[model samples]
Target chain A: MKRRLFLASSIAAALAGCSPIGTALNDNAGFHHALGLEGSLDAALMENLPGLAREYSIADISKNFPVDSLPTPTSVTYDRLLAHDFQSYTLAVVGAVERPLSLSLAQLQRMPQQTQITRHDCVEGWSAIGAWTGVPLRRILQFARPHRDARYAIFRCMDRDDQGTPYYESLDMAQAYQAQTLLALRLNGEAIRPDHGAPVRLRVPTQLGYKSAKWVREIQIVGSFAHLYGGKGGYWEDQGYEWYAGI
Target chain B: MQRLVYRYALLTRLAHWFGAIAVAVLISSGLQIFNAAPYLDAADRSTPTRRVLSIDSPADGIGRTTIFGHSFTTTGFLGWGSDGNGGEGARAFPGWLTIPAYQDLADGRRWHFFFAWIASLAWLSWLVSSAVKGNLAEMILRPSDLHKLWPMQAYYLRLRRDPPPHGSYNPLQKAAYTFVLLVLAPLILLTGLALSPGIDAIAHPLTMIFGGRQFARLWHFVGMLLFVGFVCVHIFQVLTQGFFNQMRSMISGWYRLREHESVGP
Candidate 1:
């Protein structure tokens, strides 16, 4: 009986860790795991593939059929959400919200906040530097008042691929409230631009770019991820994108 | 009685050949780009398999070709192509044509980038034309085909050996190819273009697709990893099934089953 109790306690801890607090460490974990198995296998091999060395082109983009946007200009990098025109935008917390707030850009900027200088890793094979400033997602969660049963937060965006379907993303609620997690309004000390989830974007710095859905227009807290578009939470999920975009 | 069915058209043949050459070059050179890896198995030199390449010969050839201060030179022998060209001939200078330019990645990059452009263009046109006429879509699996994938997957997992339902593509094959043609391929191209320094001035949209250069690199590498994973699985499937029939179908575009062959077994 005592042994069973210990096992039960440990299992509870594991489940709790799956929450936002646990998510902080586990988020963006994909990058650490996603950089490719070849890196540690050989350093000399990198010299041969010219296509991957410095730049890929439109022709290259067309070839991959799916890829990310260009690098953000250095000039516009920023520190806080309200510093730019973020106030002009609105944060729509929909889905299972008791009160789906269509918050304007200014409302988010005025909220209690946090700033983090974390690595934003991408699956495309590189990493970059940026200082993000935004309202703690926990603060927004309180405002959204997810019901006692919400299980996930699906991020819907204005961006679309060649197919014209709206791009969508999601995260388990456990990762939604990590202390470092934020709905960022500023990057590198400037207002977030349209290209980088202007107004507000989820900054699960521990996760991959795909996890950090850009140009987020709505936040939907849900009951379960299964059966969401394509039976996965994210837009790319339908097309075989990895669901746990940690790292 | 017997009429020749053009499985692969002339243009497609050209595309396939060039695509083969280009993809081969990209994958081969791609291993070189992953120099961050020290060894594959962490075993002795005898176990010889590079992390990315999976085969370990031609270290000398690869090592010799290094770049410093905008100059490309042969410092020593880095024998990468040895296994490719055959062990004996690889040791020999069968196709040893070295450029005497400075060994900047830019130099090797010229070939990779240009060839990548060519291959992508060819692939895109082929996909579009095929899609417009419904040929490509027909080849790919629909929801129904996906339902049939269980048996094929079972065959793959060693549950059964009844050859998968004969069609333009098995479910996994269609799914993999669709991703390659759609997701993985585009991911690589976008990241590739984003990484290009010179190409930006010519109306590049790397920043738009990804947030920035560093971000682009992160995404590009991930794409390559997926492709690598795909390549590994693809090779395994081909080997496990039958290389001759599978390879011929891809190359010739027509899969010939024996006269008495049926769907199952």
Candidate 2:
């Protein structure tokens, strides 16, 4: 009877130790907010404050950077803007901000710019290094003067899927204000090509490539992403990817 | 008369089963992750190779796995293939062998990370407990063990009729377990961390040690293969030595000693 009791307790202990299993099951059910919260906790505990992704030297840049194909915007407005080489392109900044602004590409170029050589890690198990020049996302957010309640910066893209759902993504306030996060305009000392999310794309060096939305049109600051499309978070997050894809 | 003796400690038994379950789950879920991006390429796929050992066709970018001058089109099985949905897809390892049993990269990552955390923590705890209990001393290789290993190997090869004089473990067993505990386990954990971009942000040195994240990924895959090899040999040994007796020791901490064997102090 003693042996039986020991065995029972051991099994119970083993089962109880597997708390992450519950989180894993929750993630599968499209309620990955719990995992996101866990990730945030881990970041706080394990990472240094204002965590900086590893930067590479100019020599480390790949000769042929692998580019994932970004869908060209099929919208008539996008076509008209593209015809004039995006001269009329004005990035609309709105929602949960004290000052709403519409800044053109030339106006954004006048802002303070940062250039850094960093590796872009793709979710498909590939990585490439490239030198990027862009305005810091934090600088833009500061200019917009986000309201105190604004916790997330939602990126609305010009491109849409077959179902006409616009490609969109969001970053938590902490990530949005990261030093390495940029609204990259140039790659390899040249304007980004159509295949590389031309005009303007997000450069979140610390996160996976998918987190960096391409062909950006508007920036929407929100208190929470609870009522956003599909309500999970980003476009891919709605399609089952984790919103906190820091890994 | 059969004699029953205490073989494993309670902690050892618990850790052993816990590790076994963790590894099984890790390997299956890991395969699912691998299926998302399976190829290991040092150069662009378009780069032309010397025709001598290359079975790659320029028309189709698929490369074949070569062994001992024999080449096989392994793309269908190993690196990239159909998603079983009547459309061409890139996936390594079949759905049946993976955790979710489908091509869901996001879900695969969740399962992998969940078990990885459990396995790594359990490993660290086991290491500490073993060190405190002097289990490491018993497991570590000694000069005397080197002499015993030859005869043990000879016995397994059927050149010798008698087993070597044994303590808690034979020399070969000690060496294998020690390598797994000290070498492979730590390397696997480090490479796993190296593969994570978030971890790299905080611990860049760790990622650099493995020559960057993609290289770390390649090494992680190789490590998984080695672990699978180790498991196969371990199970084979258990079956050959005394399946019931060996399993009983791990499960219940009591082993029925063989007729010729003597219990250790």
Candidate 3:
């Protein structure tokens, strides 16, 4: 009986090795600090290098580009806008800017356009390459004349997730103003599809796919994300994803 | 009579345990990350939603793992298992095999990258210290040891009864350790960096060297399997030779050499 009990306990202990003990360990402040270290390093490295994320050729485009499982926006306002083929859509630029503007989709399309084929890296360890055409975010930010103190550009989308949380993402000013950062109007030479963040989406080729939020409705320039929903900057960020997703 | 000797340095023992823990955490958390997109595809071409290897959980509650178009029901393990919350769920690896024992991709990534940093640093420190202490030279497979590899295997397999007097590490042990320390470690690190989009941005050539990011991921997974194989063999050897003596050497830098074993270096 004694030997049997010892064997049973040993097996239990071995099985417990796969438990959520690591999650509890992560609650410590030191682990939090260590977790942030790599993100800071990534941001610093990008700042120093400022190299372009690899751009693929037309032939390199993914044939069946995987779409994230984002549900179609079905709110009354979204349905109304969708019924009109997004012709009535306007992107509102607000907060910490010299001039807050609500620019129409036509106005955005009329602006000088930049096009590039770049790889889209999903956080889920998959990647796809596609061509995107849109105005550089820098031009729009310049037009708005963001305040020098404004540190982040928060993109609020029209979609609400399963938890009733509005889909949103943010980028630091440096990443926001990257040459490849775009408020994309087209994908693969065609108008964006509803399933793929139609009308307009943020295309950040350098960061993870989540950072490139789809169906972007508003761009809010802010000094800090402390006052945002969940006080964590973005929808996924609020759910514990790293805010700096350059990785 | 059994002889007690300082078989491992304090630094060596500490690094071994530290790296061992870090690697275990890394592998488990990595599987958690892998569960997020449980599919593998070609490196160059765009995958058509499905890939070479895909794990699917149909709405009918059957968990299927498909490899090369071959399907297998791997329920309660690979494709579906208990969620550690008294409910059944679909996930690539079982709950007990993952770090948090739950499905949280973000937290899994956190655990993975955190320990990845630790493991890399530990490996580098050990490499440098061992080299400085001339332990690295001692680990290399000498020409004389090459011929004895088969004999060592034969002895371990019980084909030969009497154990021959050997150095701190047997020929097979030296070869395996050298392969792991030199080849597998560097392969895993390089492939790991190749998986990072941030690193790819700054070091495109590095990713390309591995034949693209997808290939790099495949290589990284392969390297992990090799490491796991090495660990299994290592433990088996320890258990067979003398478990307590091996554990004591690792824990306290002192090992009780068997009577037939030659004196320690």
Candidate with maximal DockQ: 3
Model 1 CAPRI quality: incorrect
Ranking by DockQ: 3, 2, 1
Tens digit of per-residue lDDT, candidate 1, span B1-265: 3222336555666666676556655543344333222122211111222122222233454422322212233322342432222242221111122210112122223344445766787787777777776768756757777776788889777899775666656677778888887778878886766543323223236544564544454456567678768866765565545556656766776555645453311
lDDT of 3 by residue, A126-213 (tens): 9998899999999999999999999999999998988788999999888898889999999999998998898999998877889999
Q: Candidate 1, residue B198: CA error in Å?
A: 34
Please give the ranking of all candidate structures by lDDT, highest first, separated by commas: 3, 2, 1
Model 2 lDDT per residue over B2-63, tens place: 89999778877778878888887788778777766654533311111211222222224353
Q: Alpha carbon lDDT of residue B35, candidate 3?
A: 88
Mark the regions of model 1 whose C-alpha exceeds 4 Å error after superposition: A1-67, A70-88, B1-265
Q: TM-score of every model?
A: 0.38, 0.86, 0.92
Ranking by TM-score: 3, 2, 1
- DockQ metric, candidate 1: 0.02
Fraction of true A-B contacts recovered by candidate 1: 0.02
State residue A122's C-alpha deviation in candidate 2, in Å: 0.8
What is the Å distance of residue A238 in model 3 from its true position?
A: 0.4
lDDT of 1 by residue, A113-217 (tens): 677765454543344446678888888898778998998888877666665577788877766876666788887667866667666777765555667777777
